[model samples]
Target: MDEVEVVVAHSERATLRVGDVFLKVDGDRARAGVEARAMALAPVPTPEVLWHRPPVLAIAALPGRALAQLGRPSTASPAAWAAAGAAIRTLHDAPLPPWPGRSADDLAAALDVECAWLVADGVLPRDLVARNRRIAEAALRPWTPVFVHGDLQPSHVFVEGERVTGVIDWSEAARGDALFDLALLTLGHREHLGDVLAGYGTGPDLDRDVIRGWWVLRSLLTVRWLAEHGFDPAAPGCEIDVLRARL
Candidate 1:
C-alpha cells in the first residue's frame, strides 16, 4: 500500500484502509452556500466532502498540495485579507458543539496527548494548556467562548490564489474566543500586520490588542511545535529570532 501521509492509508478506495479510523467529512453533504464569499480566491477547489468516518477522519481527496509549498507573500493582497477576515467571522458565527463534560484541564490534556510525540521531541508550548486551566484567574472580560478552529496553523489552511480554497485537518476544532483564529493568522504573517487584520468586522466591541498579542504568541508557541516534531529548528532560518520576537 502507498502511504500518502504517515497517518493516511495508501489504498485507492480509502474505505477501511486507515490505521485509526475517524469520521468521514465529505459525507456531511453541507454546501458552502452564500457563505461562499471569500473562498473563491484560492487555487485549490473546496469540493464538498463526500463522507466523514468520526473521532479520527477521512474526507474526499484534497487538491493535493502541501501547506509548506505555498510560500508566503510579504502580505496577502488586500482583497485576500478582507476575504480571510470574513471567512473567519463566518466560521465563528457557525453553531458550536455543546460544552463537553470535561473541564478546561481536560482540553489541555487532550492536546498534550495528541502532541506527545512533539513534546517529547522538545517543543515548548506557551502554557496554553496551563493557561486554559487558569482562565478563571484572568482579569479579562468574560465572554462566552464560541466555536473556534483550534488548530488554525498554516498547515491546515489550503490556498490557490488570494483565497483559501479548503480548510481541513480539523482534529482540534473547539469552543473558544475568536482571537484564537486571529492569533494564528497574525502569527503566520507578522510582517503583514495590516493585511492580517484589515476589513475584520468587530461590530461594536472587540479587543484588537489582545488579538495582536495572540498573533505574536502563536508564532512563539509554534516554535515548540516545530522543535518537538523533529524538524530542524535552525533550518527554517531565524527560528529562534522568530520565537524571541514574539515570546
Candidate 2:
C-alpha cells in the first residue's frame, strides 16, 4: 500500500497541498477543480520548504491520461503548436504589472532574478546570465516585442486532432524570448521544427546561438535541482554539447 491522494490530475497539472492543514499550509490543495486530493506541501503564502503527507481522503481521479503516460509523443499538429505559441505570446506582453513584458527592461529583470538564483547555487556564472540578457534584448530590438510561453513542451500541450485541446502549466510563465518556446519543440520534435516555427511566421530560421543558450540554461538549472535531491542528471555532457555548438 503505497500512499496516494489524487486520482485525476486534470488537464492542468497544478501543484497542490491538499488535505488536513497545519497552520504551516494554506487549506487543502492550493488549487481549484480538485477535492479530496492529498497534496503534501510546504508553508503556503510562500513555498519555503515542503514535506509529503498522506491525506485521509483521495480526490477522485479525473477521467484522462497524461501525455507522458501514453508512452507516445504529442499529437498536436503543426498548426496547433503554432496556435499555442500565439496565445502564449499574449500572456507575455500582458499590460498588467507584476510580470515581465517583451521589452529590454523586462528581459534584463527576468534574467537577473533567474541568473542570480543559479549563480548563488554555483550552477552557472554571472556572465552567463548577463550574456543571455543581451541576446534577448537584441533579438527583440528590431521586432515588436511579444511575450512567449516561459516553458513549452509536448507534456504541457494537449491536443485532439488538428485542434489544441489545452495548453496548461504556467509555473514557469515569463515575458521574454518567444523563440525559446520554439526551441522546446526542436528538442521534442526536431523533425517538425521547421513546420512549427513556420506557422509562427518565422519559417525555421531560428537563432541557433540564442536558442542553444536557453537550452543550456534549462539543462543547468534542471540538473542543479536534481543534484540538490541527490540525483545527478547523467553528467553534464548534454549541456556541454549545446554550448560547444554555439561556439
Candidate 3:
C-alpha cells in the first residue's frame, strides 16, 4: 500500500497525495465545483480528475516539478519560466468564467482592513504598511476582465525542461485583471519577470507599475492569513520580504 503524504493542510482545505493521485479535501463544495469547472475550461494542461466524492476530489499527478516555491531559488531555466508565461497568456485569453472577481472597492476595503490590522497588531511597522499601501493603490484602477487562475502562484505552475506541463489550484479562478496573474506568478522571483514578459509578449505595453503594486498588495493581504494558516510569511524571500522590497 502506498503511504499517504500530506501535501497541504489548513483549516479551509487540505490536499493529500497517495502514489500518483492527489486528493483535495475542501469543505466548501462551491469552491471545489469552481476548481473542477475552471480546470475543464482552462486551455492549458491540467491534472485528470480521477473522481470527485463530496469533500474529496482525486486527481492524477502531472508529469513535472513545480515552477518554484516561495523563498527558494528556482531550478527551472529561463525557457521554462517563459513557457509558464505563455501558458498564463493562453489562459487569460480564454473565454471569461461565469463568475466575477473581486471588485476594486472590495479589494480596497480588504486592503484597508488588513493594513490597519498589520499596524495595530504590531505585525509590521506603520511606515512599511503605509508605503506599501500607497504602492498598492495603483492596482485599484479599472481593467478589462479576462479568465484568471486567481491564485497563479509560482508553485501552482509545473514545468518539465522548458515546457509547461500543467497548472493547479483553481478554486480562486474567475474573471479578473490579467496583470494580477502575472504579478502573482513572478512574486518573490523578480529576476524572471523579464523572461516572463518576453513570452507573454506584452513588451513595453505592460504596466509594470501595476504589477509592482500587486506585489505589495498581495503580500500585505496574505501575510496574516499565511501566519494563521501555519505558514511563515516572514520567512526569507517570503511575503514580508516582498513587502519590504517596496520600501
Candidate 4:
C-alpha cells in the first residue's frame, strides 16, 4: 500500500497525498464546496478535481513543484515569477465569483481588534504594530473588486520551468481588491516583486501603496495564527522581516 503523506494538517483542514491524488479534508463542508466551485470557474491553470464526497475532495496533483515555500529563498528564475504574475493577472480578469469578499469597513474593524490584542499580549512592539497598522489602513479604502485567488501564497503556485503549471487552494477565492493578490504573490519575496510586476504589466492604475499595505496587514493578521499552528512567523526572513522592513 502506498503511504499516505500528510501535506498539511491543521485544525480547519488537512491534506493528504496518496500516489498522484491529494485528498483535502476540510472541517467546514461549505469551505470545501467553495474550493470545488472556484476551481470549476477559474480560467487559469488549476488541479483537476477527481472527485468529492462531502468534507473531502480529491484532486489530481499538478505536474510541477511549488514556485516557492515560506521561510525559504526561491530558486525559481525571474521568468518563473513573471509567469506566476501573468497567471494571477488572468485570474483577476475573470468575472467575479457570486460570493463577495470582506468589505473595507469590516477589514478596518477587524484590524483594530487584532491590533489591540497584539498590543495587550505584547506579541510585537507597540510602536512597530502601530506604524504597520497605520500603513495597513491604506488598503481599507474603496476598491473595485475583481476575481481574486484569496490565498495566493508562493507554495500554492506550481511552476514548471518558466510557466505556471497550476494554482491550488481556492477556498478563499472571491471578489476582492486586485492589489491583494499582487501583494500576496510578492509578500516575503520582495526580491522577486519587480519581476512579477514586469509580467503583470502593473500600470499607473495599480495602487502600489495599497499593495504594500496588504503585505503589512497580512503579516500582522497571520502571526498569531502561525504561532498557534506550530509555525514561527518571527523567524528570520519570514513575516517578521516583512513587517520590520517598514521600520
Candidate 5:
C-alpha cells in the first residue's frame, strides 16, 4: 500500500503527497479555479495538472527539490536562486491573469487589522508594530500591476542543480505588484538577493526601499495567520526576524 503523506494541513486547505502525485484540497473552489487559470496563463514552468474536481486538485510532482525552506539555511547555490529569479521574470512578463490581486487599500486595511490583532493579543510590542507599519507605508504607493505569484516563497520554487525546474502553488497568482513577489522570495534569505536581482535585471520599479517596505508589511500581515496555523513566524530568521530587521 502506498503511504499517504500529508504535505500540509491548515484550517483553510490541506495538501497530501502520495508517491509522485500530489493532491490539494481547498475549502474555496474559486481559489482552485484561479490557480488553474493562472497555471494555464503562466509562461514559466508549473506543475502538470492531472485532474481537478470541485475542492480537490491533483497534480504531478515536479522533478526537483524546493529552492529553500523557511527558517532553514538554503542549500541551493546562487545560480539556482538566480534561475528562480529568471523564472519569476518570465512569469511577471507574461500576460496578466484575469483576476485582480490585493490593492494598496486592501493591503492597508489588512495591515491595520493584523496590527490591531497582534497588539491586542500581546504577540508583539505596540512600538515594534507601529515602527514596522510606518516603514511599510512606502510600498503602498501605486504602480503598473504585473502578473505576480501572490505567494512566491522560496519553498514554492523547485530547482534542479542551477536551473529552476518548476514553481508550485498558484492559488494566490494574480495581477499585482511585482516587487511584492520579489520581496517575498528574498524575505529571510537576504544574502541571496544579489543573485535574485542579478537575474531579475534592474529597473526603476525595483526599488530596494519599497521592497523592504513590502517585507515589513508582508511580515506584519502574516504573523497572526502563521501563529493561528501552527507556524512560528517569530522563529529565528523567519517572518518575525524580517519585522525586527526594520529596527
Candidate 6:
C-alpha cells in the first residue's frame, strides 16, 4: 500500500497524497465544487478530477513540478516563468465565471480590519503595516473582471522545462483583477517579473505600481491567516518579507 503523505493541513482544508492521487478534504463543500468547476472551465491544463464526494475530492497529479515555492529561490528557467505567464494570460482571457469576486469596498474593509489587528496584537510593527497599507491602497480600486485563478501562487503553477503543464488549487477561483493573479504569481519571485511580463505580452500597458500594491496587500492580508494556519509567514522571502520589502 502506498503511504499517505500530507501535502497541506489546516483548519479549513487539507490535502493528502496517496501515490499519484491527491485527495483534497475541504470544510466547505461549496469551495470544493467550485474548484472542480473552475478546473473544468479553465483552458489551461488542470489535474483530472477522478471523483468528488462532499468534503473529499480526488484528483490525479499533474505531470510536472511546481513553478516555485515561497521563501525558496526558483530553479525554473526564465522561459519556464514566461510559460507560466502565458498560461495565466490564457486563463484571464477566458470568459468570466458566473460568480462575482470581492469588491473594492470589501477588500478595503478587510485590509483595514487586518491592519488594525496586526497593530493591536503587536504581530508586526505599526510603521511596517502602515507603509504597506498605503501601498496596498492602489489595488483597492475597480478592475475589469477576468477569469482569475484567484490564488495563483507560484506553487500552484507547474512546469516541465519551458512548458507549463498544469496549475492547481482553484478554491479561490473567481472573476477578479488580472493583475491580482500576476502579482500572486510573482509575489516572492520578483526577479521573474520581467520574464512573466514578456510572455503576458502586456507591453507598456501593464501597471507595475498596481502589481506592487497587490504584493503588499496580499502579504498583509495573508500574514495572520498564515500564522493561524500553522504557516510561518515571517520566513525569509515569504509574506512578511514581501511586506517588509515595501518599507
Local distance difference test, per candidate?
0.46, 0.43, 0.93, 0.90, 0.91, 0.93
> Model 5: runs farther than 4 Å from truth?
none
If the candidates were sorted by their lDDT against the true structure, best first, what order would they fall in? 3, 6, 5, 4, 1, 2
Clashes of each: 21, 6, 0, 0, 0, 0
lDDT of 3 by residue, 1-247 (tens): 9999999999999999999999999989989989998999999999999998877889999999999998999999999999998999899889999988899889999999999999999999999999999999999998888899999999999999999999999999999989999999999999999899988886443899999999999999999999999999999999999998887
Model 2 is weakest, by summed lDDT over 10 consecutive residues, at 36-45
Q: Residue-wise lDDT of candidate 2 within 39-134, one digit each (tens)?
A: 111010111123333322222222222222112455556766665444443443454223443454554465556567767866656675456445
The C-alpha RMSD in Å for every predicted model, in order, reads 8.5, 9.8, 1.0, 1.0, 0.9, 0.9
lDDT of 4 by residue, 1-247 (tens): 8899999998889999999999999999998999999999998999999999989999999988898887789999999999998988888889999998888888888888888888899988999999999899889888888899999999999999999999999999999988899898888888898888888886665877888999999888888888898788988878888899978
- lDDT per residue for candidate 5 within 49-117, as digits (tens), equals 999997999999999899999889999999999988888888888888878888999999998999999
TM-score of 3: 0.98
**104-165: candidate 1 lDDT, tens digit per residue:** 45534544553453346455454533443233222134445765666665555555556666
- Once all C-alphas are superposed, what RMSD does model 4 give against the true structure? 1.0
Candidate 4: list runs displaced more than 4 Å: none
For model 1, how big is the CA root-mean-square deviation? Answer: 8.5
Q: Model 4, poorest ten-residue lDDT window?
A: 201-210
Clashing pairs in model 6, backbone N/Cα/C closer than 3 A: none
Identify the superior model by lDDT, candidate 3 or candidate 5: 3
Q: How close to the true structure is residue 222 of candidate 2, measured as C-alpha lDDT?
A: 50
Candidate 2 residue pairs in backbone clash: 7-61, 8-61, 8-62, 17-29, 18-29, 36-59
User: What tens digits encode model 6's per-residue C-alpha lDDT throughout 75-116?
Assistant: 999999999999998998899999888888899999999999
